[model samples]
Every structure is written in C-alpha cells, then in structure tokens.
Target: MSRGVGLLLVVWLLACSGVHAQALPTQVSGSVSEAKTRLPIPGATVQVVRTKRGVVTSTTGDFSIEAMPTDTILFRALGYKSQRMPMGGIGLSQLVVRIQLVRDSVRLGEVQVISDRPDRAIINRALRNIKRPAPPVVSGAKRPPKPKPLFAVDSTAPKKPVPTIASPVSLLYDQFSREGKQRRKMEEIEAEQRAEKLRKARAEYNKAFLDNRGYTP
Candidate 1:
C-alpha cells in the first residue's frame, strides 16, 4: 500500500509540471508602414511561416493575431518587399511590433507586335480561274404562216347603209356653237391675264410702300 501511494504522488507531480510547462496562447499586435514615408500600410498580409496561419491588416494598418512564441511571422504588401520576423525572443503577453516595408522595383523589356492580312488581289485571281457552264440556247421548229381569211365577205349579205347629214340647219348650228365656245375660252384667258397683271401691280405698290417706310420687302 505505501508503494502505491508513492507512485500516485509521483504521477500527480508529473501532471502538474506538464500543465505548468505549457504556456497559454498570446495575442500579438503589429503595424506595417512605409519605410521612407513612415505611413501606415493597410491591407497587408500577416502570416505565420511555420503553421501557415494568416491575417490581414485593418484600414489603419493594425493587426492582432494569436501566435506562439516559437512561430515566425511574415509580412507582405503590394509594391513592397516581404519581411519575415522571429517571435521566440518576444516576452510580453500582448506584443506590439512596428514593421517597415521597403519598396520593390521591377524593370520590363520592350515588346513588338506583328499582323499579316491576306492579299485581296490573290483571292480575286483564284476565284476568276474557276470554270462555269455556258447559258442554254432555245431551238424549236418555226410555226407556219397564218392562212388567209377563209373567204371574202359573202356578197349575198346586205350592206350597212352609210350615214349623211340630213339637213343644213344642224351643220350651221354646230358651227355656231363651236364659235361661241371659242369666244368664251378667249374671254376667260383675257380675264386671267388681267387678274395676273393687277396682282403684279399690287405687289409692286406694296414693295414701294415698304421701301418708303425704310423697310425692304
């Protein structure tokens, strides 16, 4: 029984020592800034090199991450060179770090572009070489000339009598009527000409009136 109690005490001590050796996770805070300007760099990537855990900086270039003392942190941002820092020697529970990022310069080479378009003249020459069939010709027998009218008009058929003026009065009346229509048409033409002349005279008078009033019409 005494031996068992001694063993139990040894186990308890070992468990307590193990719990004491394991450290609690600590929060690390850091800011990324430009090296020359010393201005905060936002949206920077902060990653643990060993565990692959990562976080991004806020708009104010501030970041907080849970990390162990044995981990190494990596900082990266656009237009800036990447930086790696070891966290083992940092002793504070809430560690605050200020990181400066250097600018990276890149040089590009000249580039040339070339284009080739097919020749239109060569394509047209190729199309003209293709053979085509000739148009068909129409060939048929000629129709006989139409035969003469079967027979001369039958002499036995009565002839239609020709009409003639029965009296001189109708002819004279028709002549008088034609003369009257011609005279009326002449009068109408003269009236239209007079009206047109009057219109032209009115237009000239109006133009003169406007000119006298110091206005051009």
Candidate 2:
C-alpha cells in the first residue's frame, strides 16, 4: 500500500511538470517615449495593428502585452503620430520594445464665400433696342391740352376725387346748390310762359263762343 501511494505522488509531480512545459508565456513588458523630447509618455495605445492586439501604457509609460506577428507593433496616442516596428527578423515571443511617438501636424481649415448681385451691364442696358414713336407736330389751332384731372386722384380714376371729411360737406353743398338753382330758374321760366299761353288760349275760346252766339268778338 505504501509503495502504491509513493508511485501515485511521482506520477502527479511528473504530470504537473509536463503541464508547465506546455503553458504559454503571459506577456511582454515595455515602455514608450516621445521622439523629440526623449521623455516617457503615458497613455499611448500600443497595438499590433495587423492582428488587432493592443494595450494602453501605464502612468509611468510602461506597458505589458502579448507580442503579435511581423511589421505590426503599432503605437498611437491622441495628439501623436503612429509608429510601427517591423518584427520580420525579430521573434515576438522575445518582444520587449520601447516605442517613440511623434507629435501630429495640425492643418488649418479652409472656407469659401459667394455673393449675389446684378452685374453693372445687365442693369444699365435694355435687353433689345427698338425704334420709338415720333412726337406729334404743334398746330396753330392751339389744341386743347389733355385736360388736367378734375382732381389728382386714384390711379384708376384720376378725374374723380375722394373728398376727405373736411372738404366733403363743402363739395356736397356746392353740388346741391347748383342743382337747386338750375331747377328754380327752369321752373320760373316755364311757369311764366305757361301763364301767358293760358291767357291767350282763354281769349281765343271766349271770342269763338261769342261769335257763335251772334255777338262781336
């Protein structure tokens, strides 16, 4: 029984050793610095751009990561240019590289402006020229001028003035007075003429009646 237990312990130890031999290496440790300043830079994202593997640098600019395949050690930060290290001749399993970041260039933005207005030639000239009508000749008769409007009025009806409140009563009164005076004069003349004719007609009737009655007219 004791010999069996000792053999079991040896088998367990040998199995553990084999497992350790097959286990993968955890990571590669590294640091990053600025190319110009030669100062350590923290927070640079160290990536293997080709394999999509990466990690951010620590506050002390140190990083620990698994190495990826060739031409793929890509380093980047917010305001810095990216850097790539070729791993063609180097074994990534032995990778412990220092990265150098350069400051990125800033480009100024561009703008374009446009405005709208009529060109000078277009506003000054007619689209097409045409002959104008000849002016009428003056005559000795002193032609009655086109009568100036009774009132300078609306665009549609220049001869008719829209009388305002201040002048309306006076305009109305003048109109009514002229009508009444003309009517009164016409009636007076008509009445006088009618009275004379009535008198003449009565004399003629009376003379005819007297002559028929055998009396002198």
Candidate 3:
C-alpha cells in the first residue's frame, strides 16, 4: 500500500509539472478578414514562424493549426499587410480568434507599352509627306458656252429623223476643249479634298494610338 501511494504521488508531481504537455499540441483556430470592411480573406497563409509549416484559410476565412505556446504565428495574404501573434497570448480557453488584416497599398513601377507599328516620329513624317494637289490656274481663259443637245426633243413640233451620230473628229475635239479643261480642274479639286481627308484620318489614328497606350506627345 505504501509503494502504491508513492507511485501515485510521483505521477501527480509529473502531471503538475506539465511533463505530458509537450506531447499534446494546442489547437489554434481563427479567422482572417479585411479590417475596414470586415470581409473574410480566404487563401490567407497561417504560418508557424519557427517550423515554417503553414495552413491556408478556407473560403470562409477559417483556419486550424497546431502550435506550441512558445511559437509565433504569422498571417499573410495578397494585397494586405501581414500580422504576427504569439501563441501564448492566444490562450487555450479562447475559442475562435478573429484576426483582421489591414489593406496594404502597393505601388507599381512604370509600364512600357510595346507595339508592332512605327514610332511617333516615323508616323509623323509619313503623315507630313502626304501633300494636297494644288488648284489649277487658267490665265486669260473665257467661260465656254454650253454645248447643245445632240438631238432636240419637242412635243409641239414633229420629231425629225434622229440626227446623225456625232463624228469621231467632233468627239476628239470636245475631249481636248475648254470643257475638258474645266472637268480636269474639278477632278483636281476632288483629289485635293480626298488628300485632305486622308491626312486628317492619319492624324486621328496617331492620336488614338498614343491615347490607347497612355502616351502623350
């Protein structure tokens, strides 16, 4: 009986000294969220600083980890500041510890936009080379009379036999006459307008190219 009492005392002393505590790891469960909005931060890493082992928070921002009182745990997530806490501070009696992480601001470096087209200088030069046609100058030229219709149509007068088809010689003369010169001038004006439109279109395209890349020049 005395021997049994002594053994019981030794067991009680070992229990009080926490000799078995090392074998029993503390279960640490917690949640992480955005501090300002109180929104759960899923995929956040909960790592043990000493062991480097970690666990990721669930979609609901819930996590469970086994750690010792002496260990330090770190909570980290993308786009948010990391947090550290001592395991001892999270007492065993505490249920779910709520960890709210502040949003971390990240500044990015300058971004370079690459393209296959020519640079600004080359594009500008190309646009400048497109020239408008000059207006024609007809010095000492008189306004030519309108040509009469080849065949006149009248209901009151009896229709005469169809006039002979215009001779080839007359056709050639009309093509090289003042009327032809005026037609050519009108064509030059149209060409100038078309060239101006093309220049404007190119300028607009360059502006848009720069704007899309956030470039100014």
Best-performing candidate as measured by lDDT = 3
Q: 9-49, model 1: which lDDT tens digit per residue?
A: 99999988766544555688979999999999999999988
Give a tens-digit lDDT track for model 2, residues 35-59.
Answer: 8998888888877666687899988
Question: How much is the lDDT of residue 208 in candidate 2?
Answer: 50
Worst 10 residues of 2 by lDDT: 149-158
Model 3 quality (TM-score): 0.46
Off by over 4 Å in 1: 1-22, 89-91, 111-217
lDDT of each: 0.76, 0.69, 0.78
Of 1 and 3, which scores higher on lDDT? 3
Q: Assess the local accuracy of residue 100 in candidate 1 as a C-alpha lDDT between 0 and 100.
A: 96
Worst 10 residues of 1 by lDDT: 154-163
Per-model TM-score on C-alpha atoms: 0.46, 0.36, 0.46
lDDT of 3 by residue, 12-125 (tens): 999876755644567889799999999999999999999999999999999999887678999999999999988774435334689999999999899999989889999999
CA shift at 198, candidate 2, in angstroms? 99
